[model samples]
Target: MNMKHVFNSNPLRYTAVLGLFAILLAISCTSEKEPLPDECEGSISLQTTIGSEANCGQSTGSFTVVATGGSAPYTYALNGGTAQSSASFDNLAAGSYTLTVTDNSGCTAEISVNIANQDGVNASISGTTASDCDTPNGSISVSATDGAGPYQYKLNDNAFQSGNTFDGLAPGNYTVTVRDANNCEVSLQATIKSDVVFAQVKNIIQTNCAVSGCHNGTTFPDLRVDNNIVAQASRIKARTGAKTMPPSSSGRSLSDDEIAEIACWVNDGASLN
Candidate 1:
């Protein structure tokens, strides 16, 4: 069978053969297309730097993130919150958190971080009362624990010092603050009482100038008695102010502060009350 003689003999059959060939060619051209490879494969990565821990009972912690390997202009989201262009997050409390970074190509990476505290600075304060009238012999001491050291101490509005003991404080209410090396601080209150000036002066007189050979029964006015000391209050203030009391032979003399205290009592009317 010759194919050319057969087709020439049947024109309809030749037209049908051409139609089938055209259909087959059209089907081959319309087949499904193959998918292209992903543009961000194995290229999306994230790095982070943790910030300082939160202060005790405060939310001051933070962190920063840097993205690499993907496209530029990355955005960040913390704990699934709204995304932002800034790479840093702040005012966070002590706890665990998840951060996500997304690049311009829609590639994403995630990391976990934690914020913590350095422990609270704890403190206790103690004080001693002024032993004499209108004097500043009072003292305060502070004991600190926890947090970092060596610590610093201060009283009220005074400047900070390395020593925990504050001496020569006047009798009154006071505030003491203790601070650690990390700058964490705690405060407390203390008080010193005012001693009875009349009693204090009588004791000073009896112990120093009212001995058997001095202002006892043998001496005029006999200052061994409290009434006698009160009666001679003005003369006593004058002599003590001149630093001539108790006599150099008696091996005794009143301190400037003690003399001032006696003068203060006399100026205030020298009442036993």
Candidate 2:
């Protein structure tokens, strides 16, 4: 056959085979592109919330760092070089620091933190006052102003409940104290006296019947002006009749006038009036 005749006879088949080969070559080229570099391997990021920076005293703050785009299980370090494993730090000293994180992919990232010292806490007691003695319903309220919370209270150097009212306390002097969370305390003094009639009777009885080892509570018959007044008066009368009221020894005896006063007080219905 002539050359021209042979080429024309199979042109359609040769063209189809060439087209299929070109399509396969295109597919292979598309698959060869290197997988997009794995999203920048071993990336890390950090965050921080700092406490007050001036006069630190119980102030606290925290920071956190995370590794992304890297491998599992990243490591952390603080102050640019200090090594650590935990991703968080708390209540750190006041200062500046740099947080660095490294991922398993060997990628590292850093962040800066400004830590400031906090102002010292201060506390003061307000609205607190010493209470009078012998007051049936006396109270002193304590309040803290411009300071931290959690306050405490005391009375007469004894622990007392907060916002407590001391009632029916006998006539005498008292001290009230208040303390704050920081253990700072303030104190005040108050005096209370019995009412007119009771006060007069108390004074007279204390001067006469309440002599040491005599009619006192520690004596044979424990008698206190605030308690067992009538019983004590009867005892005194019996002792006076026997001329034994003004005990000679111990240098402790009531004068004749004082004795008369006590006896009159007892005879007058033992009335406070």
Candidate 3:
């Protein structure tokens, strides 16, 4: 007579077991939901820094990119540059740039670069001038402002030579070029002049004056090309220009051109040919 009671007695128990199974299934599904971002891949971040310009003539600077929060073995690429294994890029000119870094997990990090080239190398001239008679062997000294030093010099398209100076240059027009370590270059014109030993005057002396008995030995100012020349160029011009030189026996009087040439020679810094 208790058959009905037996069936009804387990109804609540069966319902509770079914409810518990549903709760367990829900919890399992919630735990298995597509894993959080970090579980499979990490968020990517990039840090960058620029290196100062070191190589002079080079128009570019250097920069570095670092990546974090991704898989190992990263690859790097610049905006217009090729992909490289390392995060460092060299010889990049002064300007703004972007770097992209990719990790093994396909995650990407981007960074900005700001490099400075400062002013293109600036050069200054500070050496002595060259002239025809005096200081014929003069040299020029050059210096740089804003680039790697120990610069190189080029004269008239000649090969580059180390140092900031050009030496022993002859009197004339010159195109001087200065280059820095980075190969950056600047050009300028340089003129050399000398105030001594005018060839015309020398020829005049050797032809009309500088005679064996006149200015050879006992005479002052040695009016000859090879008559023991000295640093008396100004004195020679003073006397010659004044028409007090070349006594009667020394031949004809110097023409206006001849006198002007003497004055020019004395005023040109007296460089020797």
Candidate 4:
């Protein structure tokens, strides 16, 4: 029989052969995908300042790390030091330091921070003072010549208020002192006073009206006078002598001299001027 005739007669067998060729072609076209690049390394940065150029004992510094292309949660170190986040050191001797950062991917970067010895001592303490006057409420300020952070401050040698500011401080003399990160200190004195005469009223209230067993919070007739001297005087001195203050039995009435002073103060129109 002829070859053409034989092939046509066995069409089912030919179909099976074609199907196997298609399967082989599909397998050959299956290409593998490329892999991704490795993660980026972590990095570190450092900042520093010395307390004084003449003194090496007053240096302060801090360091931070930024991680990239690495796993979450990186670690930091300084001059072989170790920390989980940012790190700070105070009163360090002036010198050089190396900060290193390592990420979860085991990548690392480093930076250098230099601290120079100090040369001059700081003068003055930073601070301001105010009188109970109303003109100028008060002011908050600082005095510093040089050096970085790690600062400490005090008001009249008392604990310093944070945020580098104080408000509503009673009017009077005040001393403020500030020490920078390098332990260099600077101080300043300031005075704030109000023009209003009620400034004196504050003292009067504290001494007389607000005294215990008097017009204090718990006292009877509850004459809790504020900065209003006129109101206070009206309550203490009634036009009718029968209303004389500090009833005879009260045992703590204002002395004659004290009453006379209040009368004069009121007659003066309670002028703070």
lDDT tens digits, residues 139-222, model 3? 667655666666778877789887677788755556667766776665554556654455666786556556555555434445
TM-score result, candidate 3: 0.32
Superposition error at 54 for model 1 (Å): 12
Candidate 2: tens digits of C-alpha lDDT, residues 148-258 = 446566768677566534555544446555555654444444444333344555575566556664556544444464645554555655565465554544344655655
Q: After superposition, how far is residue 100 of candidate 4 from its true place, in Å?
A: 56
Kindly report which residue stretches of model 2 are placed more than 4 angstroms away from their true locations once superposed. 1-42, 49-59, 120-273
- Ranking the candidates on lDDT from highest down gives 1, 3, 2, 4
For model 1, residues 126-212, the per-residue Cα lDDT tens digits are 546454455568787777778788999988899999999998876556777777887776656565555556887787778877875
Q: Rate the local accuracy (lDDT) of all candidates.
A: 0.72, 0.51, 0.62, 0.49
Model 1 quality (TM-score): 0.32
Candidates, ranked, TM-score: 3, 1, 4, 2
lDDT agreement of model 4 with the native: 0.49
Name the lDDT value of residue 95 in candidate 2.
37
Candidate 3 weakest ten by summed lDDT? 29-38
The global Cα lDDT (0 to 1) of model 3 is: 0.62
